[model samples]
Target: MPHSQDTTPIVLTIAGSDSGGGAGIQADIKAISATGSYACSVITAITSQNTHGVSAIHPVPLEHIESQLDAVFSDLNIVAVKIGMLADADIIQLVARKLRQYTPKFLVIDPVMVATSGDLLLQQSAISTLKQELIPMADLLTPNLPEGAALVGKPVPQSEEEMGALIADLRALGAHSVLLKGGHLEQDANSNDLLIQPHSSELLRAKRHPTVNTHGTGCTLSSAIASYLAQGNRLHKAVYLGKQYISQAIAHADELSVGGGHGPVHHFFNGHVNVR
Candidate 1:
């Protein structure tokens, strides 16, 4: 008997590889799958790292990167794309070109510059290339405090007021929408994110969880947003749902003792029951 055509939305994650399975393409795949979307990947680089820190990074060759992009975009009916760490200018430019050639319905760019361990994931020089080539093409750009500051060459927002003040600057970056994550505001009582669109802005608030297991948070949130978008949700709805999902993932993070350093949130927290 012939099987009926599958209708699952497919999401592509173009990011780097994390050996620890806590972030990057690993976390993106987990978040996408856990959120009811098919997961596919095109790795830009491979990092030797754990919860502790990134030790070494080996960028995938340009030709192979292009090949992977072609293979996936050509074969898969990708509804949305979530982009993460591009090691340098060349990779960033290549990806920008491919995106132009085969545009996805939704493009979420997580400007992953610095990692949770304080390691530099993207080169300082490539920041210009990222701004010029990829940011304007993004439907949604997700950046944490530090990454946002880097993008605009300003200090990280110290308070909600400061965060609000940067909205105009962030809006000038040319992305259709921007989610400025406030997780780095450790002094704050709540983890608030500013969602800046063309004509409107919204504040997404979540209770701050006192835990260090927030690895791959940006990747997870952006991937979840893309997943929801692929599943036919509006951009605002997808951002709201994605925020809710990550907040819960963070709330349940202490349940898993994955590593000694900053650990990962429980991507499938809703699936299992704690019997003990």
Candidate 2:
């Protein structure tokens, strides 16, 4: 048997499975492929969810989760990793341990705490473990307003200055870079994301689109960032490009009528899938 020489960079997503195909591993694959990267996934949980809300969640067993990680790392050379929706402390510990074992070139962690429909995703106790273990290992941490508030032990920032301060506090927790997403802020014409590095901070802005099809914005954005990173883009450049992609996706989200509630962004807004 011979393996095909697929030289395209591979980005692995360790996340949950959304039945609606709007977020989680589904969105990750679409976003990664849209950015011209091969996407591999290890599902940590399965959720009965749609654009509206999550009705139930089933966390994948530790043994199976570990087996999936082993299978991916053993066969593929992953360039970057995007993490999302580890439901509990045990899963978080397992993921953190595996990351230490198989260190990818770029690791983007999306601290998914709650769903757009206000359903709690991550367990309350898992928050501490995620901060103490996973945050330190991540190359970049992407948190929306509510998740940021949960992580930093305070309310989400209300202004640009407050966002900067929140970034500083988040950096103190351990991630090399922190990107505080502004989607959860008050409705505005412009969506601004604050990216904070060790020495500097940058605000990546995009035109806000008025649409309810925002089911998986966080998952899509973080996966896009990981995809660009795998393609050798700099951290800031990756974030900027990811922001652009999501903005376009959001802008054209209405093109698809997937669900009655918050629909997903159009991941393949360009009308062509990039995977080989």
Candidate 3:
């Protein structure tokens, strides 16, 4: 159905499932909904994970993933789509094909490669698929230090300037805009996140919150960006709003602690304040 009154934006998250509810599809749904957008989802994989780390990952079959996509796209308005972990090349190709067929307005991709514990998540075969199919389709791409390095085949960025430079190179690789996350290495407890647009070398800096509970920050940020885009915000404005939302979520993370190790950000920080 079309959006009621065409005011509330509808967003879809195509990603893997997180049993522990800290990251992946779980985080995506939480983030999008928390931002006042209608959230729909198509799960790519079912993962057994917790605060400590990922225990097991079971990728859904290619056909099943496509069916899930069809079910959502055929029924929902789907103003924007936020794509997360697709685990393997076949899954990535499936998602790419569906995107080509449906062609959603705003596509935000979060290139999830490694866990917070420094464990590899995406298979090597999927790298080519992401670069060839997904990145080019993305209106905006969000990648952390490790994911960015994996995409560009370079070393971890040493400085904010270097990261911005690397982000520009990455945008040239495929994405129209890039948000290279600096959550991996913050200077003086102040994290730096940069958003670079096409035809412009200037990097837009966003204030980062210093918090250890960042298990699903990348997924949450990308989803929030998609939600904002669905609501008709400009590219830079969407990124800025997403930055603020994630920062507050991170700052309030301690109160929403669910895991013993790396925990989730408070996606509903505004909702909590409204209740008070």
Candidate 4:
């Protein structure tokens, strides 16, 4: 049997590579595939990392990055793009330019700054460029509590009430929608994320899974959202579905023992049984 065409939704992920396989481009691909989307990637940087922390980062040259972007955008029928880590200002500007040129149907930006293991994946100087160039172009911006606070120059919200108070400021950053992750509020029993759009808001609540294997959670979540969007789900519904996916992934994290430190979520938790 000869197939004439493939109809799978193609989702592109532009991010750095995580040698650990728990986060960055690796995690994005896993999440997208697990969520039923074909995944493509363009690596901006590569990190020497593990479940413990990032040891070193080697950013790809700008021209090569541009070539990768052109190759993917020109060929693939990309429906949604999930952007993760860009190491510096130059990379951010180039990506922003390419995005303007190609303009995929849906764009999910995970403003990844600090990693779960307390490593700085993005440069402090690049923050301004990211804010000015990439953020406004996002169809959905997914930022953890610390990233949200950095975007708005405010303190990390201590409680849900404080998270509510920062919604207005977050919206002002110019993304069409924002998913403010509240997992950093470890004191809270529930992992709450606020979905703030132009005229409405919703609090997405999930049980906080008790485990240290939470590496790449943010990357997995944003990629899952992009995967859903590529599958033609509306933004609100896609976000909810993404939340559900991550929650389950977290719930099953303890099932894997990848490393000695913070480990990764089970991106394919629904697939095969983990035999001991």
Q: Rank the candidates by TM-score, best first.
A: 4, 1, 2, 3
Clashing pairs in 1: none
Report the lDDT tens digits of candidate 2 across residue range 1-276.
Answer: 543446578999999999999999999999999988999999999999998999999999999999999999999989899999999999999999998999889999999999999999999999999999899988999999889989989877787677877866888979999999988766666889988899888888887898889999999999999999988999988998999999999998888888899899999889884422
Ten residues in a row with the worst lDDT in model 4?
1-10
Global lDDT of each model? 0.94, 0.91, 0.86, 0.95
> Which structure is stronger by lDDT: 2 or 4?
4
On TM-score, the leading prediction is: 4
**Least lDDT summed over 10 consecutive residues: which range in candidate 1?**
1-10
lDDT of 3 by residue, 72-101 (tens): 888888899999999999999889999999
- Tell me the deviation in Å of residue 48 in model 1: 0.1
State the lDDT of candidate 1 residue by residue for 26-123, as single tens digits.
99999998898999999999999999999999999999999999999888888999999999999999999999999898999999999999999999
lDDT of 4 by residue, 246-268 (tens): 99999999988898999999999
Query: Ten-residue segment with the worst summed lDDT in candidate 2?
Result: 1-10
Instruction: Give the CA lDDT, 0 to 100, for residue 271 in model 1.
Output: 69
How much RMSD separates candidate 2 from the native structure?
Answer: 2.8
Per-residue lDDT, model 2, residue 19, is 99
